[model samples]
Target chain A: MSKYYSKEVMDRFMSPKYFGEMKDADAVGLVGNPRCGDEMEVYIKVREGKVESASFRTLGCAAAIATSDVVCEMITGKSLEEAVSITEKEMVDKLKDLPHVKVHCASLALEGVKEAVKKYEGK
Target chain B: MKKIYLDHAATTPVKESVIEEMQPFFSERFGNPSSVHRFGQEAVMAIDKARKKVAHFLGAKEREVGFTSSATEANNLSVLGAAGGGHVVTSSIEHSAVLNPCKMSSGSVTQVPVSSEGVLRVEDVLKEIRSDTTLVSVMYVNNEIGTVQPIAEIGKAIGEINKKRKKKILFHTDAVQAANYLSCDVSELSVDLLTLSGHKIYGPKGVGALYIREGVTVSPVMYGASHERGLHPGTENVPAIVGMGKAVEEIDFRKGEEVKRLRDKVIDEITSSISGVTLNGSREKRIPNNVNLAFEGVEGESLLISLDSEGIAVSTGSACASHSLSPSHVLLAIGLSDRMAHGSLRISLGNETTEEEVDHLISKLPPIIKRLREISGR
Candidate 1:
């Protein structure tokens, strides 16, 4: 594990449980720009107004990948409103703590979740 | 888990022979060269011997060499010292040591662009020369992409241009990356000033040398007791200097051919086996030890991490690994998109590299890249 990343971050990044595309995802949230070098897509499957499954595809650094994985895990089994309300602070705390410069990675993951939820509500 | 170091361009472990030469200076021979005592005289003789070795390595006179803390300081003494209050011309792909100093210069700086292969065009550099331009600083080899620039051609062209001009435009090359494999003869390259680092060439760190051609006048950047001909003023790092000199003397370019074969094997194996992989820089003009590549749809930091887990040390040019979160400026200047720049990896070989180590890297890379591409859903 790199000293630059917390153990929790490295663990999730190395073996992210919720990484990949969900072809049948009811709604998807895409956040970040490729130009910025961190692009994330969050996929959600909805069941009875709650998240049945969540997955993510991230093209970014270790912190960004870890945050995406944690966010996906956080939204699973949670109601759409609860998932949307999951804060960047909560996500960062779950990963122990990201490097100060990489705190924005949590925010990017949060924005992905919000976008996914917003898409599901609109549909 | 076998550990393999492939980040030699960043630094190399000091050679055992260099350490053996440096051991006495740290204790038994510890004396300030500036002092007038008997011990000081001994230190002076040691320094003179090391200076002579360094001078011989660069094909320069003994007096032309000046010791600095590192190549960065030597570069600063060359740029900030010679081009103060005067316009400067430099390349866009120089290491931060040269680029940052040019930025800090009081004079205006014109950065000439490079080809997509990361090779700087001599004509483009000459086109940027202005009447007020006093210095043209370029690197002998790019640290990131490993592209070797045409230093001799640039120097000769600048020399010809200086013949008809009133104020001679001084030519300088940061040869830190080239010292291990390329010739740095000051006259052959026709450079007025040059920079070299100790750690980059399997020598101890905290020591560097600059070769200032005879008749060149460079002002001191730092103010202190008159040392290094008043160009750089600081207590000499005697042990590191001795090690650096020994390292320079030990350099044998013949060894580079075998390293080049290994580098080519890595490149050929990776590129042929992996799809969507592109090599950066001019392969023919690149240094023997460097292999920089960009993996499509995969983030470089993730690849670096995965490789690190397997005990293989490498580096990336991705923005994620940088303090400023900016992708490598060299890759960008070479016409790579931001996404591609974020996927660049640099693997540098060293004298100790072997076929088994190369095979280990080759065997490990495909799966790691495939896994990253899968995670990114590309």
Candidate 2:
């Protein structure tokens, strides 16, 4: 176990939730860095201006995958406004804390959610 | 659930025999070798026997083997000692131990690049050789991708130059990764200095040897005691040296052929069956234990973590650079795009690895890649 990582990170990495894509999704969010070798795609199903279901797919480190799971759990069943407003801080705070090096994962997760919501709104 | 370790190129577990050999040195034979008493003389004898074992393994004169804390120290000493105020030449794919020392040398440094497959061209190295170049250091086998450099061919080229030059240029090789799997006879490799680490070959850590050809002069890196014949000055690590000696003495080059079979099976199964998979390095010229692959659409680090969770231990790159999120230099040098480089995995087999362990890895890896790619939706 790396001293750099927290127990929460390891737990989340070990059994990430809400992983994989959703069928008949209303919107899809994709974000990645070719250089960093991290790519994340988030799928959403919206009902009555609220997030009905959420799921994500990602190719990255443990932190990136964990962040994706965390973001999906945070936004599902929430109003689109609330889901889009979810900050990187709010997601990380929910994870207890992310490592300093893995903070980018939170941002990427946020981008994934925001992109999904934006595509759903047709804006 | 049994954990499978496939990271031997990083560091290997100490063998039971090596531990047994090292036992007496730490307890009953605990003596500062500098003392003139019987106890000290006994300690001295142990180190001498260890040195002779290492020397015989490398086909070197017994006196030419000098012990150091690790291969990194040996590399530093060789580059700094021999390249005294003169230019040094090295490769881009060398371990940081060799690369950094050459970088800090008093003389100018030139790094010859390797081919996209991570093979260093002899002609490319020859072109970088300057009249004032005092040393040329290259690794015998690359750590990340396991590309075996043409050391003998490079040595012949350097030898030709040495014969014609007034200041004969010296050649050094960081053979830390090569000692277990390759022919390391210094005369055959034709290197003036070679660095080897004990931990890489199932011996105790913090013990390594630098095989310096007789009559080759390298300035001392440290000052204090006259130990290691003034080249590396420090008190001897008696127990670790004994362990290292035992490790070298027991090494069987033939066993590596079995390792190669298992290594190839993993490579063939993974690359052929898995999507977005590509083998890294020149497969034909690689060391027997090495299998480095890049998975397209999946990040290497994530795959590494997933495999770890599945009771399989491996690496995305060199253990030294694992903490850094940046792509490996060796991968980039081999013409892998930032994406491909970032998605690389290195699985090195050891003597203890079995066909069952490899079959488990192959069965586990495809699903991991599939899941990560599915998550990515790309």
TM per model? 0.97, 0.92
> Candidate 1, residue B16: CA error in Å?
0.2
List per-prediction Cα lDDT, in the order shown.
0.91, 0.89
lDDT of 1 by residue, B151-186 (tens): 999999999999999999999999998998999999
Which candidate number would show the highest TM-score if scored against the true structure? Answer: 1
- lDDT, residue B215, model 1: 91
lDDT score for residue B163 of model 2: 86
- For this target, which candidate reaches the highest DockQ against the unseen true structure? 1
lDDT of 2 by residue, B173-285 (tens): 99999988898999999999999999999999998899999999888888877888886677899999999999999999999989999999999999888977889999988
* Candidate 2 chain B lDDT trough over 10 residues, lowest sum: B369-378
- So what's the TM-score on candidate 2? 0.92
TM-score of chain B of each: 0.98, 0.98
